[model samples]
Target: MARCEFCGVEADFPFICSYCRRPYCVGHRLPEAHECPNIIFARPPDHVRKIFEGRLEEPARHVRPVLTSELKQLLLAWLVLGFCFSVNSLTAPQLFITTLLISLGTLGLGFIGHELAHRYVAR
Candidate 1:
């Protein structure tokens, strides 16, 4: 049974917001005119707290379209860095330091690329 997100009362007929798709029981649900365009309506915070249970919980699914592409591009970029790190590891006396620096730089680039993909592809 759908319940009000805010007050936790059983809902007669929950309204699923077009943006976020969270079920909101009527009384707890804010009226549409008051909602912000940038903010998708969500189940009450307590509901999400119950659903997630912990701060470390992973999202149920990777619903974003860019996640796959971001991961693929990040993998390829890191693969190239791995090759370079391997070469440096063989030749350098300070292998650990160089590897750490290169790894951090690669991660930074990968994050930037991921953000770019999301920005370009997001609706």
Candidate 2:
């Protein structure tokens, strides 16, 4: 077992400081805790800004109007999916229509939102 240099405690699993190259216990594992002389090396590098520079620079896209065919297809899909999903809940005739409508609206919106998010992220 390695020993902590600062506290003189024996450690089964010791933490080695990247800056000072010294073994330390959990209590004094960090550079600050062990009072490392080369403390500047412990600081993380700020490379995110440099790495992602100009990556998000994209031209604005023109908003295209939805076609009537696309609207019909979406509605048809939503209706079919809603009926299939709500088939199990058909025991109560009163709640059958409500469940179907709710399923249709939620599934349609959820699918649209998911696609939008994917496009935005993949851009």
Candidate 3:
């Protein structure tokens, strides 16, 4: 409910200027835009400024590895499922191997596809 000090317009959502501690609308929120008196406060404190400056000296490490921690559990689960299917399918010698393989392959695909769909939807 605060009004923009610079524009004198009532701000529905105010952005409080860190430097001057004055509420402003998005347009006049920046210290430069509002002609903030205490522009020196715009710079971060020495310790924090030093930490950020130090980081800039080193080349950024941007290699983000994809997580595969659940892979072992997923593979183990597929093995158990395949074994169960194979055991039950032992009665038919000719069609047993083909049926088990095809079913397990499709089941794994379906499971992976379903999980990916859920992830995308949530994201």
Clashes of each: 0, 0, 0
Top lDDT model: 2
lDDT of 1 by residue, 30-105 (tens): 5463252435443344433233455555446746775687578766766666656556576665885677567757
User: Total backbone clashes of model 2?
Assistant: 0
RMSD of 1: 15.7
Per-candidate TM vs. native?
0.26, 0.40, 0.39
TM-score of 1: 0.26
In candidate 2, what are the lDDT values of residues 4-69, reduced to their tens digit? 999999999999988888899999998999999998787786644333565754445797677766
Instruction: Report the candidate with higher TM-score, 1 versus 3.
Output: 3
Model 1 clash pairs are none
Highest TM-score among the candidates is held by which one?
A: 2
Better of 2 and 3 by lDDT: 2
Give all candidate RMSDs, comma-separated.
15.7, 9.5, 7.8
> Candidate 3 lDDT, tens digit per residue, 1-123?
899999999999999988788999999999989999998778676642335655644545786456565656666677667667677678887677886787679776676677668768997
Ranking by TM-score: 2, 3, 1
Better of 1 and 3 by lDDT: 3
